[model samples]
Target: MHDDEEMLRRLRVDDLPPSMVDLNRAMRAGRRRERMGAVVAGGLAAVLALGTVVVVAATTGKNTAAPWPGAGPEGSRSPEPAPPLGNCTIDEAPVASQSRMIKIVANRSGQVFVMQDPLKSGNLLRWMDGRQERIDGVPTGDGYGTAAAVNGSGAFVGASGYKPAWVYRDGTFTVLPLPPDVSAMSMVGINERGDLIGTAFYWDGRDDTRAVLWPASQQGTPVLLATPAGWSSEAMDIADDGTVVGYLSHRTDNGPVDITPMAWGLDGSARRLPVPAGWTPARAGKRGPYPIAIAGDWVVGAGARWNLRTGTAEVVEGLMPMKVDKYGRLFGNVPLSVPDNGSTSGRPAVWVNGDVQPLPIYPDRPEGTLFSVSLDGRRITGTSYVTSGAFGTATWTCGR
Candidate 1:
């Protein structure tokens, strides 16, 4: 880690000990420029569907099928399932749950399932499965549980239910306990090789937090990330090359705050990302690297900060900073601060790149959102809970 990058990371996080947000206007702007994607000659762009934790299963069963999530524009496919009606943030509501999820896994052939459900009391466990259901294995332990993980093949999940992180393989839950020095942990993500990384707290018991990575090789204790001493962190995503996105923290003169949208590497080098120019009054903090849906020199995630490039952060310019796709296209819709109370109003949106606005869903769906993107990033899957003024979750494959 260069001293300059460390300095930048610190400077970016000098305020706000906690979070980031500024997405509404960016979506509106992207909507104006969306265009349909190209139809390739059977290019193997497959979409595997499933759910993660805290979701009721969609009874509609079919392998290659579109959702029956009723009502879109005059002529288009049905939307995805609506979430249980409520005001949970996109992160709070889910396309999938710990029980089941569709991850665009990198190293496997065919779809996989990372399932989590309850036993008696607050105890929890994770069951991993590959192409076959018979090959099921479950990992169990203490604490209340929920599995927030990266799907596809090489996936990882952690439970508030358990103390250490676990890996799911072809029908097996490999319980990789943390080092004696590490205490509570959250498994944030896994690379293609199943290398797991997340935030960790040491047994020393302080308000301190650091990033930790446990390799599939199973040899060493979780290594602490080289970050500043006082701040805490939350690991959002990881890349095949092991780039981690989260935040850096510090207590400004006012109170404890965080420098959001920060990124770090496997080598312990960290850099604070710059906020977009659109932020109001030019605030200094940034938001996230939502999981780098696509990997490379560029990072991608769904978040909002003033687009400093355009000088709009403080002024209320209604758009968001969308995720960058492997194709280098960015798909961002409005954030949760729209006119219809932001959370519910189906702010009909589009994807923009310069002057193009490729529309996503029909003008009136239950609720419109651009939530968790796919690994390939060809599509984005958010929720549209139900028919109560734009109140649902919907995901769309970016198209023409």
Candidate 2:
């Protein structure tokens, strides 16, 4: 694996809380499905070459790759059907050439914002009504441009270099002026009203980081969100209503770190979310419950969902809700444990009212992961790993 890819894998695996119970059952079912999937893997190279299927492969294979055990032609077991999304339909998005990987950063009202090549040479792309357009003119120093969030108005927030956060709107990239000392000022989330939130690092001797918010106009000075005493914080996401979600961690004398999930309001007020019941301490390689996405009345973290209205949090077994759409449908990955190696993998999954359903992967694809889901859950976007060893972006829409 490439150095960056290896680092990412380590981060993701390390982020998962320790293995839970019933993993054996889940693994058994997954292995059976994997076996079924392995049977038709060989024929997919042809389908991938045609590029006619919605879940298209990134490259054409040489037919030398070995299929899984019990291999056969396509339709050998009838591929798994897509999960139903009531009153919502999915439309596949076009894959851009040379786009090795994709991350659908945001979607609203059928308009999708995707960040192509999330790790290297990033480009901001938008999809709607069967047309895809790449927004040009994002600045870069030595590193590439990457977007973290988009608002309903089509304005996106990100950072170009260590010093300047940027807002891309209507084919223009505007610098978000900050103090000269601020570094690593990446915008993480934005709301429909064009309000944005992100973290800015101060390169003081301690290397502290704090959250900041920018208003829609981009005229006034950025507002710095509160950080607790002796704790450094990073704001990860923001809801349309201006609620910010992130984590708080303390480092004493550069020792072991402890993180606490946090939420901030429009007024810049901060509160620590109580750890859900039955929550266990993350093992040395695991991360504790940390909030990742915030939608109306809900905050999704590492292993649980917090209901802001009721002040109640529930544990989601085997799934960590990553993005919660407007209609409350949850999109994330299910961690799969391999009985042989004691290692784990993530399967793209969706949840409604605590019921989980794994998303379908193509016969030729080794794995898949979701990045964004539309408000009504009709559109889901993610990436699939093809047998040719390349990653391709995929969009799943509810169809008749």
Candidate 3:
């Protein structure tokens, strides 16, 4: 990714909010010698590799170097997966090698987008190895009805516009009609059953953002999910079982600002997951989860914290629970540490129950990382670069 230098530059500028401006200045005003090897927590992880499958070592006998528990592909010196409970791998590569710059989502299945790497431009979004589709009329940019979620068939792209949001299934954009002054809506995610979970707002959009479950048995107006008070919400990912999770802003009685993170579930009513106890003194914000599997009782998520521990949400610590293969096991905090030297303030480390393991990187720095475990307590994703390199938005999926 080419944005490290740019990330670093922006960190000095737009990275810190006005509230954090004083904190940044104070940290710099002090001497560097006092905090040279400090270890802070609560930062989000960024996936750095490009390819879908990344193997750094074989998973067999030479498990010494591999980060995973099983043997990797033949002839590949893979990082042995860690203990069964903590298996993982890391890989990072430049985005310029291949692939379009903008087509948006990038998993094994490809989509196209505008390329903006240095002198690159004019690239357009289209199907894999195909021509661009024509839209008779539509907007663009922040207000454009961008399709953020794809259905099981990949035929529909859930999109949103400045006005009503729509589901672009079967090549045509069908507006998800809502009755009476429904000014805004957008799709957040889809479940294995092809159900969509998202949000919609009114100019007087009720009290706050709503968590919407779509394909209404009958649609008069978009449904508003019950959420915690003062907890402004937006629906994010949805699980196969229909569990939803996202963020909420914490507030005081006097209506002042409070720490907020990717919040999931409501207070008391919803069975919210727990994080470190030090987050909020008033219990205004619940320890939000990412809804990984949502089994019988558990709702897992890429948990986020305000980091009373680190004093910054952009640089926090989290866990990547390992592959718990058998019973009576506890790998304990196989923590996913993040880069918070405050160099390039991109995203914070927010792995929920993700298994964290050390992987190959530039010599001399054990902290340089690139792999994060998913809350299934198994799957992993992350990024890595030697020399404490930079970041690009597309570089968020470089793990194996």
TM-score of each: 0.56, 0.70, 0.47
Report per-prediction Cα RMSD to one decimal.
15.8, 16.4, 16.0
| Ten-residue stretch with the least lDDT total in model 3 | 62-71
Model 3: lDDT equals 0.33
Query: Least accurate stretch of 10 residues (summed lDDT) in model 1?
Result: 35-44
Candidate 2 C-alpha lDDT tens digits along 248-312? 66544534456666677775455555455555554112455578887665677766666554344
The residue-by-residue lDDT of candidate 3 on 117-179, one tens digit each, is: 222232223333343343333333234444454434443434434445555445555566553
Alpha carbon deviation, residue 374, candidate 2 (Å): 1.9
- The weakest ten consecutive residues by lDDT in model 2 span 45-54
* Clashing residue pairs, backbone N/CA/C < 3 A, model 2: 89-398, 90-397, 90-398, 91-397
Which number leads on lDDT? 2
CA lDDT of each candidate?
0.40, 0.56, 0.33
lDDT of 1 by residue, 238-339 (tens): 666676666554444554243455666665555555443333222212223233333433444433321201111111123333344333334444432333
Q: Give me candidate 3's TM-score against the actual structure.
A: 0.47
Number of residue pairs clashing in candidate 1, backbone atoms closer than 3 angstroms, sequence gap of 3 or more or interchain: 76
Off by over 4 Å in 1: 1-137, 142-145, 160-162, 179-183, 201-205, 216-220, 256-260, 276-294, 300-323, 335-350, 354-365, 368-372, 387-395, 398-400
**Which candidate ranks first by TM-score, i.e. highest?**
2
Q: Which stretches of candidate 2 lie over 4 Å from their true place?
A: 1-91, 95-99, 102-104, 116-125, 217-219, 283-285, 336-343, 398-400
